[model samples]
Target: MNVRQDIHSAGVPVLCQSCEARHRGLCGALEPDQLVELSKTASRHGVSPGAELMGDAEVVERYSNVLSGVVKLTKSLSDGRQQIVGLQFAPDFLGRPFKSESAINAEAATEVSLCSFPRTVIERMMRVSPGFEHRLLKQALNDLDEARDWMVALGRKTASERVASFLLMIARNIEPASDPAARSASFDLPLTRADIADFLGLTIETVSRQLTRLRTDDVIRIESNRHVTVDSLSRLQQRCGD
Candidate 1:
């Protein structure tokens, strides 16, 4: 898993003010000097689609804040059945602090960029910085809340509703440097039909039918099998019954 060396920027210390994740992620909790210290150990990485970022039970040596694209958190059973437990978006932190091994497998759902640093550095910082600790705690709670909501969607919602709900979630979350003023948006499906099926707890055929149904009803426009364009956010939300 040797990445291109060019992708690794020399850890020249930098300020937090210009970081994209400064206000939204872990960097938001850091003071000026602390930010510089973090920069010294942090490097940027570009991950290709389908690459395994971390594996279940693997030692956690480093942590990353996702800069762009989607990551799927998966869990496998003893029988080899796999489930997509969760999805992480840009500016979301990855890795478990204070834990030696990962609980789930994290794979890149699309081409992704990350700001990564050693786990020990983050752990040490958390011990001394209450703000950092609070931010991590808040992030954990938010993830828990989202997990609970997904549990309801999977357990109570119909197949079609589940598909619509997934689409709506992506539409709201996936932003790719688009015009902030634009109400309409378009992005490629980061996960394949099979992957989506695993995530939604449906068969591939069921997932295909639901997507076609959405397109036929004019809720969305599809180009290549992977590309999706939503005409209106409100219309998509309405179809999701949200």
Candidate 2:
């Protein structure tokens, strides 16, 4: 009758039967039997905000799926300056494949839930499962496309537009299945103002000023500094300079 019921009827492992990743992420490519086999070594865990899930050049031991909450991907300069390169949301895969060490640092931006499996298990599956490999490729390509779009925003967009675009990106990704016609959305910001400023290549003051402008214009509402409610997604999109 519903998605949960359908998953139950499919007889997948209990751990995966209700997982969003099982339906929309790489696990979607696996058969029920495969899921059962994979679940033998899979583990679910919670990570608090500010926790480092993986570090730059860290030895790869496991791969994970973001079951809930946000993860930030960052790159550091030799001088110790770090840039927020990307954000990962629920159902997104959380590691690099075929690499012995990670190239970027991944940190939890909010209270996060993850389902992790040993690196060898996933790599072995990829070698044997064409569907699994294809799903991974598709995600990689999608990330590349998003990175390119963000490059344009950072390189050419004004401070105001960049802020709007960043907010729009978070709203869209945080709830990928949100109804398009609803034209409204609300969610807590996954990153702090400083992190947002770094991601958008703007000063913290500029980010706050633009956010205040958006609030004054009725494009969005901010509560308690982190929660954001976009009153009109269309109006917000209009400000993005897309």
Candidate 3:
């Protein structure tokens, strides 16, 4: 795994050259012309592992849609304790709109690529594009839904159960382009113990402990640090304490 941190010195900024028109997190109302204009406002870039995208209280000038890789959102307390607030996968939206500052910093959990769009441009385009406002509203609603679901995992689920739910959520969010196997039987583990700890509200030791339990139980096998072969997804789902 050539992590983005080492293989490249500088990242190349790419416009949204995809023929798919709108990327996954688009307001969903953008037309061809609107997309081109939106692309004009966007600049692609990459970040190394542990690189901070938006640090605490950083004014978000642009929002991004992940083209590849994973980003983790986290917040640290005054005592230096950090909590993983969110995990963003490819085709998912990033950045805060209309907010004065980012509540959490987004960091590359791994090497990452992003399509960055200027906030002002997006806001203007949304004003002109058909149904764009509604799409933005819906986007907010969807985010809220995900947050609430994870809140339950954090507040009530067991460690193993939390890991299972996280895996299934990531599986559903991963774009087909990002996963060639698409066999419905296998997927990858893109997060590290530290990453899992933050999102699952457990210690790194706890995450590692539960992962061992999962492996021993025939739930999964570690392909590498960044990959996992799911052996029994039904059983994995059941581990989520469903």
For this target, which candidate reaches the highest lDDT against the unseen true structure? 2
lDDT of 3 by residue, 130-230 (tens): 57767667777988998998888888887788888887666655544244444344556667777677778789898888878888888877766656667
Candidate numbers sorted by TM-score from highest down: 2, 1, 3
Candidate 3 yields a Cα-based lDDT of 0.71
lDDT of 1 at 184: 71
Cα-based lDDT at residue 176, candidate 1: 64
Clashes of each: 0, 0, 0
* Root-mean-square deviation of Cα positions for candidate 3 versus the true structure, in angstroms: 7.1
Model 2 accuracy (lDDT, Cα): 0.91
**Candidate 1 lDDT tens digits, 1-242:** 21232122433234344555776888888876677677768888899999999999999999998888999999988898888999998788999987899999999999988899999899988998899889899999999999998999899888888998898778767766234455676889889999999999999999999999999999899998988998887777776654
Candidate 2 displacement at residue 69 in angstroms? 0.5
What are the per-residue Cα lDDT tens digits for candidate 2 across 1-242?
13244344566877897799988899999988788778888989999999999999999999999999999999999999999999999899999999999999999999999999999999999998999999999999999999999999989999999999999888877864244466788999989999999999989999999999999999999999998998778899999999
Measured with C-alpha atoms, the lDDT of residue 225 in candidate 3 is 60
Candidates ranked by lDDT: 2, 1, 3
lDDT of each: 0.84, 0.91, 0.71
TM-score of each: 0.89, 0.94, 0.82
